[model samples]
Target: MKIRVTGAFLFNVLCTISYTCCGETVGKRPPHIVMIIADDMGSNDLSYRGLDQITTANLDAMGFNGIIFNRHYTEPICTPSRAALLTGQYPIRLGLQGEPISAGEDRHLPPDVQTLPQLLKELGYTTHLVGKWHLGTARREDIPKGRGFDTHYGYWNGYIGYFDYETKSAMTITSEVYEGFDMKENFVDAWKDKGIYATHIFTEKALDIIDAQNKDIPMFLMVGHLAVHTGKNGMVEVADEKTMNNTYGYIADLERRRYVDALMNLDDSVGRIVEKLQQRDLLQNSVVIFMSDNGAQIRGIFHNGGSNYPLRGEKFSHHDGGIKNAALLYSPLLEKKNYIHDHLIHITDWLPTLYSLAGGNITSLKKTDGVDQWLSISQNKPSKRKNILINIDEVKLYSGVIGYGGRYKLLNGTIQSGFYDSFTGEPQSSNKMDYDIAAILNSRVNKAIKKSKVPGKHLDEALIRNLRKSSSAIRNNSKCNRGTEKYEICHHFCLFDLWTDPCETENLIRQKSKDDIVLNLKNQLAEFWNEVSPQTNKPVDINSDPAKYNGTWCTWLDDEFCIKIKTNNQNKNCNENNRSTSSIPVLKL
Candidate 1:
């Protein structure tokens, strides 16, 4: 027997032989992951997604060339959605499910949660984040740099002025601007005061990171664009004048025109980054995914001017318009391109999927609410995701749970019919799914799943158990009603099938012989509440820490009240409010 070296010894010998004989080393390099998230972008914002008013050529191309997620869902707001994305868990589990991270509020992603960057870092990937980090900024270990990103350059709050880099706070009584590197290193006066539009500045910084990357190491970049979200003064504070004038020359309304201009600039940002990747010879080796944090602001809130027509509610509601977002995934590793995936994908799925794509084993990670659908996604196979527990939060004025299983979905306590079919770009009708659509998508995913050599079903038992519990408790308690006493079950509960009627025009709760379905959904909703509700934490008391706001009140000498200082030049006389006698200039509300 020729020495009979096998098993571990044989594997080591084969590895040595491959390294010596084959010029290539350590298998294939992991693909670089680029996750581009847009703030307040709607499902129909892109021309390809049925937007006749706006033109998003680059975004359209990415969708057309990549995989389109017709039914991808995110949290109804910004902070919770981001938390879900990073932690691969529902925001409720992270205690950040309630509200957005407001200025100076001492709350953040819990330190125990394993983030995407932290997982990728173990795989030897260099991680960098550019743009909105609204997850948290309360403690020193709560920010992006402290979490996992090797380098972070952006604001930690929700919406900031695109040009001024400031956000108006009722608590602060002034618009505070934050621009800096790691918050831990420099929390005070770290602004650059470049006066450039926020979108452009963020783009340049992203390019710099990409250009400076070492080719040997795989990279993961998260570019959170602050475009489309209204600025401090409203939506009119900033927009590329040249692009705005050129694109919407015929639009009469200034605000509407400005909104369109901001959208066009957002599209351009997408194109520029793709172009940069192409020029760097990294496009083919990169995986690019684009999605919105939540639905668009269609109701003119904060002077917003985007539309989510045909879909129901705006950003902060339980309607599909609020949770169902515009999303696409592109990569050379994917066998299927120019396709629409109708499978239910939640915001939490990205972390596990991406971590696996970067050569991580999903089974080795901390128990997450996400499932590894890499095989199903990359190859265009039928997604293994059968049910999705959207969210249940009592934090907002409109609070309820949304759950989907098979062709049926329930919103709150009322049940309706119909589901939005992304492939046909319309709502599914009757009790049947479009076979032609299924065939087209399934064939591609099946092939990819086969080639991946990984099992399509990567659901963890713990996650499944949790989901099963949540799905069974939808309308169990009357007190759980989102502060509304209208409904008998849970006061604010409304249910819809989403398969037969996508617009939620009819309620099937009082229908004939649907008690079993209604009871199961109620249990599901109740389970979510019982598990996630207790995790929600209260916001930190900003009044307890006055030192954090020192010198950060008025950085600009030309603010509305600052005009008094320029003419008077009396520094000591500026403390009119007596809020702080420390001599820091305060903006009188």
Candidate 2:
């Protein structure tokens, strides 16, 4: 006799199958995830990467003990990179691949997309955001709280003043600048935090959350630091005056010295957070991630004196220096550690990777450009990803299209008026002051390693020396012969073997042997561009100006005049054929 199968029985069978595919056994407690993101950090800014100008002992320790993703990539700018991380899909799919969201613009991450935090929340995790939320804020549903974060304690716009917590935007029509307080604590003005430095305040809030978190339920905390990014006036903010003047006084460039101070404060925040995790007994069951949103802006808007030396291009370009970033993962759950992973990985892979690690069903997620790399990351297996569509932007001028497959990368456009096509940043120089890496290992690394209970491993001077040697070997092997040319132009098309010429130093379009590779990558780029969504960027809304909202940048779509202005703009666009463009009315004081 045949057994009857009902819908409920089929659903149960599918769930079991999906769970098995997730690579995690049922009934196991999911690991806590703590993600720390730095804004506008350079590719070679860290001390562990052989940059002798600045020291990042805490971050260096993490790299020394964790898996360093040498080929990890992100978008060339802030909004796109954050969108890819949160949704596990390319920003082009959500129309966010254009320029970053301005203070009063109407663009934001689409409301219907399920975010990483939302998925974790379904698996019994408490999600919190403790820093920048640059996706969107024009609508109430676009804020962090509305997008699955249980609580948000930071600024809603892009970068803000470290001490004053203010955002300034100039009107499109008249170029009139408007300034306002941008900090908020879960949808209200956090005026009390105005005078406090952002890094210190954000770190304290994270520590508090960790201290008060429920032990039974898993937690997901994201610390989006404002360090290394320039303040409201396009100047680097110094966190410690004495440190800059005395410790880093040897650096002739004052701007670079200020930036180094800011980075040190960020490093201090990392150390404190890790120490808290160990104290709270969360170290053994937690996965910690540290990364930058994108490459640094060496010279431009929001310039912070950052350097991506030895790599070409800056923040807004598609070059390796612009999109390639330094990232590492640390946890006791990994079977692999202390090695540089050279396989290709993209920012979009985090959504499915993290979800699978959280014991969620990956088959349930909608069609995404990202693929699960949990096994590849945790088990040291070869990456399942073969190609990455860097970006395809049609709205912004000089914004290019890029694609990577196998060992080759293709680019068809330029960025920043093609001014940053060469290597940018400070010259490689010797250290003026010596820092003790052994002290950090003894004080910070050994304690955490002992608590983590991973067997047969001890961090010491020999281990660190070995790690530095291996890392240097990887870096040296990837370097190609630098061309004597001053600048490499890519106005039409350019091809380079990323495995050999990681710096984009030589364009191989002239080689006859690489025709097949170039054609294949070009075809892939075309397919990605075909699925591009119309960019959602809108003109600056003067009605959303902070001057009208009690001197704070806020959601103004609820106000009567704001709604009326939106309607008026819509009507004006509809009747443009009968009216002159200059007839539009300006905002009245």
Tens digits of per-residue lDDT, candidate 1, 337-446, equal: 55677677888889888877666668878768887776667666766676676676654423454444335556652111112211112212123221122222233222
- Which ten contiguous residues of candidate 1 have the minimum total lDDT? 415-424
Per-prediction TM-score: 0.74, 0.89
lDDT digits (tens) for residues 523-582 of candidate 2: 888888788898888877887887566567888775642322235455445334322322
Instruction: Give per-residue lDDT, candidate 2, residue 100.
Output: 88
What TM-score number comes out for model 2?
Answer: 0.89
Off by over 4 Å in 2: 1-21, 24-27, 397-406, 425-435, 443-446, 474-484, 560-589
lDDT of each structure?
A: 0.62, 0.78
RMSD of 1: 12.2
Q: State model 2's lDDT.
A: 0.78
